[model samples]
Target: MAERSTPGSTPGRLLAPPSLPDGAELVMRVMPMPADVNANGDVFGGWIMAQVDVAGAVLPARIARGRIVTVAVNQFTFKQPVSIGDLLSFYARITRLGRTSITVHVEVHAERDPVNPQLVKVTEANLTYVAIDGLGQPRVLTRQV
Candidate 1:
C-alpha cells in the first residue's frame, strides 16, 4: 500500500488501487480531456486544482448539512502527471473540524492503460471549507463537537 497499486495476476486484467486512506470517502471521479491539458500535454494544474476543491468539499458539506464556501487550499501536491483517458478517482477525509470550517485531505489516483493496466497517484491536497449561510457569511458547523 505504501507503493504502487496492486496488479492483477492474469493478463488483460488489473487489480483495483489500494485504499487511499483508512476512512476516506470517495467523493468524485472524472477523466481528463485533451482540452484540460497544459502546454506540456499533462493536465493543467489549475484545472486539477479546481476539481480538487470540488472534491474536497464533499465531507464538509455533509457535516455542515448545508451550503459551504472554500476558504483556502492549505496544501496541494502533484505527485504524477495526469494523462487524458485515465480514470481518475478522488478520495477525501476530514482532517480537522472547526466551529465554522472543516479541513479535508484529498488524494487522486489515475487508472490508465485499459489493456496493460496501471494505477498511479496523480495528486493530493489539503483544503479548508467554511459553512456559510444564505447571506454567504460563515456559519457555525453543527458537528463542531
Candidate 2:
C-alpha cells in the first residue's frame, strides 16, 4: 500500500493506525473533492473539523429529539493529513449525557489507494452539544423514565 507522511513532517515516517474503539457507531462517510483542498493539495483542516462537528451531532440530535447546537469542541487532533479522493469514515460514541448536554467522541479514518487498500486514522475529536428551545436557549433534557 502507498504510505505518505503528514505534510511538513519528516518524510517516510508512518505510524500504524490504532484500532477503532469499541461501541462507536459509523455516523458518516465522505470523500473530499478538489474544491476542498488547500494550497498544499491536501484537504483543509477546517473542512474536516466542520464534518466532524456534523458527525458528532448525529446521536445528540436523536437523543435530544429536537433542536441542538454545538456548545464546545472539547478536543481535536489530526493524526494524518487528508488528501482528496480519500474515503473518510466518521465514527462517534457518546461519552457523557448531562441534563441538557451530550458529549461525543468522534474518530475519522481515511481509506486510500483503492488499488492498494490502506485505512489511516486521520482525525479524532470530542464535542459537546446542548438541547435548545425554540428561542435557542439551552433547555433541560427530559428523562425517558
Candidate 3:
C-alpha cells in the first residue's frame, strides 16, 4: 500500500494504514454531524458507541430472525478520535453463536481527507445480543432442520 500521512497526523510523514479485519462484513456507514461533536471538537464517544450498538446488531438480528436485545458489551476500544464530517464505516463479524445469544466483533473505520483520502481504524467492540420473545424474555434459537 502506498504510504500517506495517517489520519489526524501532520502531513509529509508517511504511515501505512491498518488493514480491516478479514471476513468482516460491512454493516453500516454514517458521517457524524457538527451536533455530534463534543466540547473538544471531536465527535462524542457516546454517539459512536450508540452507532456501534446498532451496527453490531445487524448480523445477530438476522440470525435471531426475531426480536433481539443487546445484553452485553464484552469489550470496546477507541483507537482514534472521530471528527465531524468523517465518513465512518462499521464492519462486523459473528465471533460466537450460542443457544440464545450471539457475540459479534465490530470495527469502525473513518475515511477522511477528500484530497489525500485516508481510512483509519477508529473504534472496535465486541457485543452480545440475546434473542427475545413477545414477553421480552430470552428465547431459544430454533435449529434449522
Candidate 4:
C-alpha cells in the first residue's frame, strides 16, 4: 500500500516500487518537510541517512527478537535530491547474518512529483545492526526456525 504524503490528506502520488530486483521487500514510506531541508532547499542528506538506518534496523530487530542498536553504517550514496512534497519509500533485505549482528541492504526511492507517480532511486546504503540487551550490551542472536 502507498502511504500518504501528509498525515490526513490522500497521497498526491503513489510511491510503490516499479520493480524490486529480487528478495527485497518494501519496509516504510516517509514524507520530508521543510524542516528536514538544508539551506539549499533540498532535503538534507543526514535526514535520508537517518531514515535508512531506521529501515535497516527493522528486520534485525524482529529477527533478533529483542532490543537492537545501530552498530555501523558502511556506505551510503545519494543519487538524487529529495524535495518537499516528495514521497520517499524504503526497501530492505537482510544481506548477512553474524552471531550478534546482521547486515541489511536498503534502497531509497523518491516520487519526484506524486501527481505523476514517477519513482526514482535516490539513495542506497548498507547498514549493520547488532542485537543489544536492556543494558545496551551486545548479545548473540538466536536463529529462528
Candidate 5:
C-alpha cells in the first residue's frame, strides 16, 4: 500500500472552509505568537474571544463617538483549533442598535499558508457593547445623521 496525504496535511496550508456571504468587511488581522499559546501548545480561546470583542466594538464606538464597554457575548462557537503562526483576521458588522447598546456579529478566519493566503473561518460570535460615559457609566446612544 502507498501512503497518501490529505490537503491539510501540509504544515502550513489550510483546508478549504465554507465561503462567507457577499459584502463582508474585514476588521482586523493578528498573528498569535508563542506568548499567546497555552502549555498544551494551542492558542488560548479567551485570547481569540477578546480579539473578537475588540473587533466587534470598533464600529459601535465610532458611532457612539465615545468610550464603550463589552456588556455581553451572546453566542460564541469555535469551529477549529488555532495554532501559533496562523494569521487571524476578524470580520464584524453591526447587527442591532439599542438605546445604549449595540449588537455586533463577528467572524474570525485564520490564514494557514502565508504565501498562498488561504483563509479558514475558525470562530464566530455575537457581542453586545454599551456606550459609556467618562465616568464609566452607560450612556444613551443617539442616532447620528
Candidate 6:
C-alpha cells in the first residue's frame, strides 16, 4: 500500500502503483516461470535483472539506429518482490543521450491476483548503452529523433 507517485508513473490504488509516464513505452511483458522463482517462492531478482537489461535496450537500440550494447546499469531499485503467476510489464524511456551512449530509465510493473487484479511497481532502473560499430567499437550517433 502506497500513496506516493512511482517516480515516473501516475498514482493508483494502495496495492496498485501509479501508471507509467506518457513518454515511457511498454517494451516487454512476461510471466515468471516456476523455474525462475527462488527458494522463497518469489521470482529471483537476477532473472528480473536480465529481463530489465533487455527491456532497457529497446529504446537505445532504436535511437542508435544500429547495434548497441549495455555499458552500465546506472541505478536499480526494487520497489516490490515479483512472484510466479504475476504478469510483468517492462516500460522504458530515454533519459539522456550522448555521442556514443544513451541512458534510459526502465520500470517494471506486476499484475497479480487475476480476479481482484493488483498492479504494483516491482522494480525500476537507469541503464546506459553504447552504440557499437560492426567491429564492436563505439560509434557516434548520426541523429537524435
Q: What residue pairs are clashing in model 1?
A: none
TM-score of each: 0.87, 0.85, 0.86, 0.85, 0.80, 0.86
lDDT of 4 by residue, 20-91 (tens): 657888788899998999999999999999889988888888899988888888988999899998888899
Give per-residue CA lDDT, model 1, range 56-130, as digits (tens): 988888789999999999999999999888888899999988889999999999888865567788899999999
Off by over 4 Å in 2: 1-18, 143-145
Task: Residues 1-145, candidate 2: write the lDDT tens digits.
Answer: 2355655655665534458787788889899999999999999999999999999999998899999999899999999999999988898999999999999999999988854556889999999999999999999988531
Q: Sorted by lDDT, highest first, which candidate order results?
A: 3, 2, 6, 1, 4, 5
User: Model 1 lDDT vs. the true structure?
Assistant: 0.85
Error of 4 at 60 (Å): 0.7
Candidates' C-alpha lDDT: 0.85, 0.87, 0.88, 0.83, 0.80, 0.87
Q: RMSD in angstroms, all models? A: 3.8, 7.4, 5.6, 4.8, 6.9, 6.3
Model 6 per-residue lDDT at 116: 58
**Clashes per candidate (backbone, < 3 Å):** 0, 0, 0, 0, 0, 1
Candidate 6, position 17, lDDT: 45
Angstrom error of the Cα, residue 20, model 3: value is 2.4
Tens digit of lDDT per residue, candidate 3, span 1-145?
Answer: 2234656777766433357677788889899999999899999999999999999999998888999999999999999999987888898999988999999999998878867777889999999999999999999988421
- Runs in model 6 deviating more than 4 A are 1-17
Worst 10 residues of 5 by lDDT: 1-10
lDDT of 5: 0.80
Taking the tens digit of each residue's C-alpha lDDT, what string does model 5 give over 1-145?
Answer: 1122345576533344347544356778889989888779999998998888888877788889888889999999999989998878787778888999998888888877644555688999999999999899999988642
